[model samples]
Target: MSRAEETADTAAAWIIRRENGDWSDEDQAALDAWLAASDGNKAAYWRLKHSWKEADRIGALGIAAVPTAPRKALARYGMPVALAASLVAAFWIGAIPFLSEPSAPKLVASTYKAGIGERKDVALADGSHVELNTRSVIRAASTSGHRDIWLDEGEAYFEVKHDPRRPFVVHAGARTVTVLGTKFSVRRDGGDVSVSVLEGRVRIDENPAKDGRPASTTTITGGMSAISEGRSTLVTQRSEERVESALAWRDGMLSFDRTTLADAAAEFNRYHRRPVIVTDPGAAGIRIGGTFQASNVEAFARLLRDAYGLHVEIAPDAIKISSQGVTAL
Candidate 1:
């Protein structure tokens, strides 16, 4: 295949992967290689992908083709109405009796959803990466002019490409994280929203829903984390190690250091069909630190017991962790 053709095919393959919502490391590597090879390759790939999307929209309306209009209005055999009908029919090559034009939402304004206990990786038009965690729903609007991923609900880790002109924005609650380039996780559990920075820098702010409105912008540096409570942005030292622990579900490993028994139990409970019951808030505050397999919930519970000197009560539906008459402190 010619260089242009090869690039187009690569883009097509990536498009298929995206349509399937199965973006893998292999596709990422190909995209990186394509970009490094030549600027022309990127341009050609984008052009074809853009065209393909338009074609998809057309096909969705049950149309095989939309014909071009003739230059200027012209009388054809003194039969103006017939010519108009033919033009309309040509423009809309679909099933007859095409009822009221469906108010189809824009593709990106639309969303791809994942249920609980599910994780999916998707590649956007601008070559950015997003890993949607369990019970997460995200919408991606990918155009050459702009790229956006809006996390409507649940959690997602984003790796946005560097583009000064087109800042990648992730909207989760009132916390809108804007980035030119970075890797970060934005999670909304209930009414609380947390922004954890993994790489590069991100501006976490309260962007306005309407134009001409003021915003509350807070810049959280790398290794730092913030949570939203009410109208203010609260900043605190996000245990770099613990931040990794919070997202360990993505890696199939649960890592924790200096975390509380209560918080740790909560994390594990998300995966458990039964709750990790905590009776006392005091007991839950015991210090904990360790790395363990996330798949084995019982093992993790034992690790907590052995480390924190807490008593573990195993129940059919849940496990309860409480004080052993002493604290780990």
Candidate 2:
């Protein structure tokens, strides 16, 4: 009923879920966040986990443990009440080591972030590599059973190491990308998520009951892309050129093949502080094609002036483009 008892009860529940053998990456991430919240939570979880292991050992030896009442209560409640009781008893008698002397090294989640116009490279413990794009954030951790990554914001490219025994999963928004080994990228824009595979294959799963629709899973191979918005997902095949263009940001370049000025501006704004604003509908509708440096907005604006003959207004916070009384160069 008290805080300590509640913490112990939660810890016991986690142990049961873990031993059930169906524990997921999301579940492990939630447990890690809980343990990192406070020292009391860590102590409670480790104490209960240690005691549960001991209980399993004794049961394997056909020994009659003293916590008979808690064992009988497990059948009715479906929880490890015996382990909880044993943990409490051990604490009272100083029989079990606490957080100061954990049985094994704790696996803490690692977080990586990239600022505006900055890219970061991370080499994971399992030989996996991650490249975070500008203004992106990700959290990763690897256990003996699986590797998990949570894309908190923006975009990231993943070069996953091949390990069939340990599945690699990336959680972005309401969708999950699962794979054994692959080269892919995940981009999160508000409620929409996109997955593009360059090599190998990966499976994308949408969360259940989103927008009143049942969940769905789509497997995409190399040169394939999946875009999920709300509960609807569209998987389409991409040509090699399209795939390269989509991933051009990794090389600090933005590639566009007849992309609209409005759309192109949106993509470039992701990496720069000053935005490109097309005030004229005609200018916004103009289609352009080329590759440009992602961080160089001034050059892009100059191109509109010299090549397109559009009126370019440069302000302190933004670059405004208009097609008023303008003729093609």
Candidate 3:
């Protein structure tokens, strides 16, 4: 097939996925790649997308008109859009709209994806250790003088061997995290992306050239972490060992050093089916500290219940948490 045909096919697939509201990471990446390949591709995709959204609006209007026979004419207009959207992507997982467009043309672009409940480790040519966790995708290549990886989604732990000339940079949405030689994990969870350092130090900054945002910076040392909305963190310069508690899950152990119960429970949810949901927002910041073996996170809940007098109730599809005893703030 011609490149345009292949591109159109890919775009059509993406449109169908989004219209169905079941767009997956794979489909979204394909659409992003197609857009970055040429402005023409983006224009085509957006054109279809606009048409589809308009169709959805029409469908909603038609649904409202069903009770009002006087509004039946709007129903016909809605049918075409509904049909197009059905062929587009209205029922599948919604397409993520955060893909980045490149600044200039390039010869080749790479793609990487990880499945659910999966873990992978790799040693780069420069002696860097890359550990990719479940359901993550990242792509990287060196073109000019810089080395970088675009993390489409999920988390990755990187132990970058020192290279002064070619510093390692990780790209997640609008953020670009840089490291000379260090051990760190970058996790892109929904809108809250986090970076935790285990060894050496790394710099976190915005990529203005890509997103045109003012540059903000942070330096994370071993056992330190920073979290941001999308990519801006309200917290930073934390203790390094504390960051270890969060990263220890990769090693099959859970560690906590003066972390709050709410934070610990959130970590537990990462590995549990029924996530721990804090009923009381006040409990989210309660102070707690200790080293507990990384086994079933349920054990941690029981420990809290027994020792701290907290109420633990397990629902059919979820775990609910609430304070039982009067506790000091």
List the lowest-lDDT window of 10 residues for candidate 3: 65-74
TM-score ranking of the models: 2, 1, 3
Candidate 3, overall lDDT? 0.64
**Candidate achieving the largest lDDT:** 2
* Higher-ranked by TM-score: 2 or 3: 2
Cα lDDT computed for each candidate against the true fold: 0.65, 0.79, 0.64
lDDT of 2 at 216: 89
User: Residues 61-170, candidate 1, lDDT per residue (tens digit)?
Assistant: 45423222210121221324433334323323332222224642223344666665567888777888889876788767755556667676788888888988887888
Candidate 3 positional error at 158, Å? 0.7
lDDT tens per residue, model 2, 140-213: 87889989898978999999999999999998987999999999999998778999999999999986541345
- Which residue segments of model 1 deviate by more than 4 Å? 1-107, 209-214, 236-247, 324-329
Candidate 1 residue 304 C-alpha distance from true site, Å: 2.7
Question: All candidates' TM-scores?
Answer: 0.58, 0.70, 0.58
Against the true structure, candidate 1 reaches a TM-score of 0.58
Name the lDDT of candidate 1.
Answer: 0.65
Q: What residue pairs are clashing in model 1?
A: none
